[model samples]
Target: MIEVTEKAATELKTLLEQEGKPELALRIFVAGVACSGVQYGLALDDEVKEDDVTMESNGIKLVMAKDIERSFSEGSIDYIEDENGKGFLIRNPSAGGGCGTCGGCH
Candidate 1:
């Protein structure tokens, strides 16, 4: 299972309120791409696929695709708002070296 930081929870709550999507659980998946070889994707989903691992924490439900669960075993989901702006930030331990914005990640 993956852990979600308090900040991330709060951010998600705010997003849900703003988007009018409270019924949706936050879905996290690792797609095959990014400068680090894999990248994270987040979305509000209402249905859990057959290959998903579902967990609930801090009043929020989270679902991670089975294929990405292993890669997400040791990561933290964080929400940060700084000079650059605010959004979800994934601190994955299994990613390779890079800023995840390098060329050829696509």
Candidate 2:
């Protein structure tokens, strides 16, 4: 039940078009673990492993490994642009997470 914010969905679609990979799904994975909790990363992927969980958010396809799905079962993806710059971010309410950045670690 991961949700993609309107801004994030729009930006992701544009990126896919730019890369000529409009059909690729956004893949989410456990990049590492920090004091904030599990750190997740995103990428465009066409492959879905047997243990991968798939879903759609804001009309965008999303895929993640089964092991990491629970962490984001009720999360949302957002795009933020401010003084610090812009990037995608995953917001998981159930987890004590912070500082998961698409551009760089804060």
Candidate 3:
């Protein structure tokens, strides 16, 4: 299952509050696959499709597409801060290099 860190959860809550969409769930999915690895996208969505997988973490609801669920199954989303800046990072141990069509990923 996907996990959300406390900091990430807090940030998500603040963003949702600012957007005035408290009912919206955080949607995460694989937007594309590249040579570096799979790219992830996130958004606040109020709609939940029939095939979507829903889970709650730190009191926040997360929705993901069923077809890409395995790509994020054991990953954790975290909010981090450093000298450079701050942003959300998805740490997925299963991710690997190369796009699926490149025949370079094994």
Candidate 4:
């Protein structure tokens, strides 16, 4: 199952509220794949497909395609703020490797 850190949940709530679509669920998916591993994607979606897996994490609703769920089965979504600024970070143990952008070749 996927988890969301408190900070991440709080940020997600703010973003949803700002979007004026609090009823929409956060959709997470695999956007692409490289030689290193998989890349992720996120968005707010109002429709849930038949093959979607829906769940609540840290009080926020999340949805994902069943076929893409395995890569995120044991991970947590986190919000990080540092010199680089603030953003959402997906910490998936099952992801195996880092993305190609981080000095890794695709």
Candidate 5:
């Protein structure tokens, strides 16, 4: 199970509103190809895949694909905004023994 903080939930809500996609939900995705062993990806998806595990927390819907769900059983995603603007930052505990930002060939 994944957890979303109050700050993160608010950030997501803002994005959804801006995109004018009320049907969209936050999808927590992971891939094994970065310079590191695993990399995380997050996006607002309108459709839930068949192999996805869905959960709703803190008034936000979370979807994790089957392959990613195995490696990313838990993690935290936050919305960060600074001099560079706004973006989603994923803190994945499963990212172990990885290389650079690519998360590949670890």
Candidate 6:
């Protein structure tokens, strides 16, 4: 199962409202592999194929490819804000990385 923080849910809702696509669900998937570990990508999608696993958290719908769901089975998506900027972050212990961060891994 996946989880979404309140902040992320609010931000996503705001984004959908601004984009005029509130019906779209958030989709997450394996974007690529980096030096640190597996990378993930997020987008507003309207399609949920048969190979996708869907879940709801914080009143927001989320979908991910079934084949890669194990990679984030118990992960949590949270919003982060600091001097460096702000964005959504996915944290999964099974992801196997130095910091579990998606920033530059150099």
Q: Give the best candidate by TM-score.
A: 2
Between the candidate structures 4 and 5, which one is better when assessed by TM-score? 4
C-alpha displacement of 83 in model 3, angstroms?
A: 2.4
Instruction: Quote each prediction's TM-score.
Output: 0.80, 0.87, 0.85, 0.86, 0.79, 0.87
> Distance (Å) between predicted and true CA of 83, model 1?
1.1
Report lDDT per candidate. Answer: 0.80, 0.88, 0.87, 0.85, 0.78, 0.87
Q: Which runs in model 2 stand beyond 4 Å of their true positions?
A: 97-106
lDDT of 5 by residue, 8-79 (tens): 998888878898886788887654465555777788898898888898778899987887878887878777
lDDT of 3 at 85: 100
Candidate 4's displacement at residue 83, Å, is: 0.7
Ranking by lDDT: 2, 6, 3, 4, 1, 5
lDDT of 2 by residue, 1-106 (tens): 8899999999999999999988999999888887677778998999989999999988799999897876678989999999999999988887774566543444
Which portions of model 4 miss their true places by more than 4 Å? Answer: 98-106
Report the lDDT tens digits of candidate 4 across residue range 1-106: 7898999999989998998888989889998876567878888899999999999999889999988887677788899999989888877777656555777563
Least accurate 10 contiguous residues by lDDT in model 4: 97-106
| Candidate 1 lDDT, 24-96, residue by residue in tens | 9988876557556677888889898898898876778989877788877777788898999988887887777
lDDT of candidate 3 over 2-79, digit per residue (tens): 789999999999998999888999899888768868889888899999999999988789899987787778888899
What TM-score does structure 4 among the candidates reach?
Answer: 0.86
**Candidate that beats the other on lDDT, 1 or 3, i.e. the better one:** 3
The 10 consecutive residues of candidate 6 with the worst lDDT sum are: 97-106
- What lDDT would candidate 3 get against the real structure? 0.87
Question: Cα deviation in Å at residue 69, candidate 2?
Answer: 1.1
